[model samples]
Target: MSPVSPLLELDGAVQADGLDAGVAAHYGNPMIEQRRLLAGEAVVDLSNRGVLGVAGPDRLTWLNSISSQELRSLAPGQSAETLLLDPNGRIEYAMDVIDDGVETWLILEAGELPGLHTWLDKMRFTLRVQVVDHSLAYAVIGTMAVDPAAVHLAPAAPNGVALTWRDPWSSVGNGGFQYADAPAHPAADWHWTEALVLRDRLPALRDAVRAGTVSAAGTLALEALRIAAWRPRRATEVDEKTLPHELDWLRSAVHLNKGCYRGQETVAKVHNLGHPPRRLVLLHLDGSDAVLPVHGDEVEATKQLADGETERRGVGVITSSARHHELGPIALAVIKRTVPADITLHVQSQGISVAAAQEVIVPQSAGSVAEIPRLPRLGIRTPGH
Candidate 1:
């Protein structure tokens, strides 16, 4: 009588247990199998991510004005993360932008493209940038044995591709390589080997997703790696009310010195004066057997001397949590100003205990200096003076 639920169908590559059914579910945790495949050697498909192709002469300049990161100087074939914001400085979308020089492509979280494209169109009245949706593009991600000779295999990802490079943490045991988006082929005259893998030949691999070759991952493994790499996710980090700096997005996303955009005023004021109202912290849970708190759980801090009736102090809130098989249990929580390094807190609703572990987020130092890398030379007044 009713349409079948996606969960009910349970067909190939659709194994989604331990994941939130909402669209936001993929925003926080990536699948454990995805992580395992990444750790070992396997190409994991990322078809759910959406891609946008932006081109025309003004592409870089146009993106510079809208995003938090510097885009003007990005060379062709480079990729970088950019944050799209609302007038009040709230993040509308977090995107991975790859500049192919002549054209640019943006890869965003699933279900985010339509809104972002429409917004970009509304803002592009006089700009020369042309935005087109190419959500069907395929992306395969996995670690490969690096051969220095591989540079010849693919034109060393051009300067544009260099923009997306982020050090791989788990591979930190070895000299970490970076990620880049490049065309699958080379100029025919160059006589180069293309980084192309045919889909038809990988029948066995395809069957794995159908027969479960690609296993589904849980939030646990994904959260642990995110903590290690300091990567930002939606609910776990970026929120409607959260600023770019709060997530220390400067390391990748925010270009601090960039020219004026909608929320630059607030970003500059808070950055110049002091730390933001809240900070993102990595949680090392002590009570492994205890259930991890779900997002929206109030984090209650108790004073040591307050016996039996401990005064409830609301520091901040739990943005995300996971039962990391390796780490036991862990979470990423936001805390208000000046929380004691040793303070213990509870995910108020679930009664799970999470302790502040190591602080991995990059700290904001100076306003003007921080702006230098973030701002592009757009020939316009910079955002944060």
Candidate 2:
């Protein structure tokens, strides 16, 4: 279990449960906190998020060779996202990366640090790279503000470059792909960032919140905004078989043209000759029930049988669900790639069926973007012949 954040001692702070345990979920009122967060008037206590440091001259090159993103040319203070995938092209770890001239900082889920650090350490054989877990020394603070300075939190700058990682999900990165096809992507306005601060600064931040000099929101408000922006979080969206294309993660975390890596073959094949087995969708749940569906809840679709009867079949499971300020009860789910986009789905939550309308994110025709022409089959007649 992770250490509980000291901010929980603040008045009205509620400790979050489950994956977000040890951090504040909300500060007594969630709805108002969401508004403040959206207005850039609040900062989220993400002290539980993991922080890792990779120092050495070969940090960028070494990282680029292993991850899905092309990080070899990352300049100091430039933010990028990358994914470490299994040989089968399934996402295993996602990282928010930033180089600070002297070291490369990786921010990820707290529970994922142990595995990622171990894997990175093993891969550093004979390399000039040094992997160090800094989770105990530093804490992460999240905000939707365009700049961290707005929240009065000074990011650590050990190398003269602030250790802040701005999210790259707002646009399709170079050598990346966007499968969502939304002319106006909701992420276009997603100005999210995470700033690493010294762990000892938590008390000062808490005092700032108490003095009302800095407003503090919780993880719940941040989660709601993240869902509305169609951002896929590694903690909730990734499973054993999750592919980057399934979550439309290629828009930011993958470089389709990068050099060979662990999952390069599968990534190339899926993009050029095949399609992802599943696609992500946004679900607008019926808020009338006032029963919000939690993660792992079954998402079912009604099918008309040949016998003229209807049956509810499990199509997918809700990965992350939240009550957005404007969108109301919304969730992100991964359904079959062949599932019809117009179909109405139901979420089985606490024994009650909640009707959900599908908002297509990754379309059924998500992959096979390469325009390779077919060759004539052997022993088959050709028109010219």
Candidate 3:
């Protein structure tokens, strides 16, 4: 059994998921709640999320040298994100990072904590860094579509509150780059913020919610808005073969001009010379009232075989799906880089085929950032030479 959340009593009817997080998959009506969030009239409880703190003098520089982001100059209360990748440039973990002068806090899924802590502990060696899990010490609260100034005003119990983390997703930040070429990126409207407060402060927050002083939305509402924003989550969107470029994560979580790290060479090589093996796409699903597809559902495209018979060919797999208040049914899928750009897709879920229209998130032409010209073979000299 999971430990009860301090706010669980107020939202007991909400469906429960991991880490005893007090979130209903939907609170009776997700559509209504979603509107409340977009209007900045509701808060989402993130107490179930994980928080880790890195302390000591060498924390910033040490983190800069080990991750994809340039964090050595991280200012107090500034927000940034970083990814832990395998030496081969495959994503291993992701964390939303913030600093408060003395400690750098990382927010991620609870399941990622132990592994991250152990890994960081081992990597410390003789560095002046101490990593500590702060799940017991702090909790998180969030709101959507608010600017930085308004984000700082996010509701909080007047107790043990630490600091707020305004998501840097609205625009490209220092050292980061964007691959999504659409003139107007949907993520530009994603004004998400998470506030860190002492664990004991949650009860007071719950009291405020019960007293009608504040409103709350469930995870279902959050998911809908997130999908619409084309945001890639580490828990749902990542797999063993995942690369930052595949999901266009370089726009926020990666730093192109940063110092070398475990996977820097591969990140540089792929972005400058190679194309990602896969591409991330947003699927606007058929709204004929069909069953919604779950994660790992195969996405197929119509292909003509050699015999002149039309066959459904494999194209991709859905990573996350949700029923948006306005968009009805939507999902994020990962498809082959070689898939035809003009092909129409269909998602196969529990044997039910649902038509899917792709809205390019990562284009097939992505990569080659350095733009170095292709030089001729050494033996084939130019006429002038």
Best by lDDT: 2
What's each prediction's clash count? 15, 0, 0
Task: For residues 254-358, write the lDDT of model 3, one tens digit per residue.
Answer: 999877998999999999999989999999999785689978999998888889999988888999888988888999999998887676799999778999888
lDDT of each residue in 1-385, candidate 1, tens digit only = 1111222222333333332222112322345543553343233333344567787999888888877777888766444667777777777888766676677767665557788889888988987888987644333122221321222112223223432322212221111111211122111111101121222223333444345434423334444445544456753576668876666554456656678977777766666555566666666666645666677777767765535665767877777766544565666777765666455665565454455453434332323334444566667668795
- Please write out the lDDT profile of model 2 over residues 68-98, one tens digit for every residue: 9999999999999999999999999999999
Off by over 4 Å in 3: 18-22, 145-162, 376-385
All models, RMSD in angstroms: 11.3, 1.8, 3.0
Reference-based lDDT, each prediction: 0.52, 0.92, 0.82
**Candidate 2 TM-score, C-alpha based:** 0.97
User: What is the Cα-based lDDT of residue 212 in candidate 1?
Assistant: 43
Which candidate wins on TM-score?
2
Clashing pairs for predicted structure model 3, backbone only: none
Residue 264 error, candidate 1, Å: 2.0
Clashing pairs in 2: none
Worst lDDT 10-window in candidate 1: 185-194
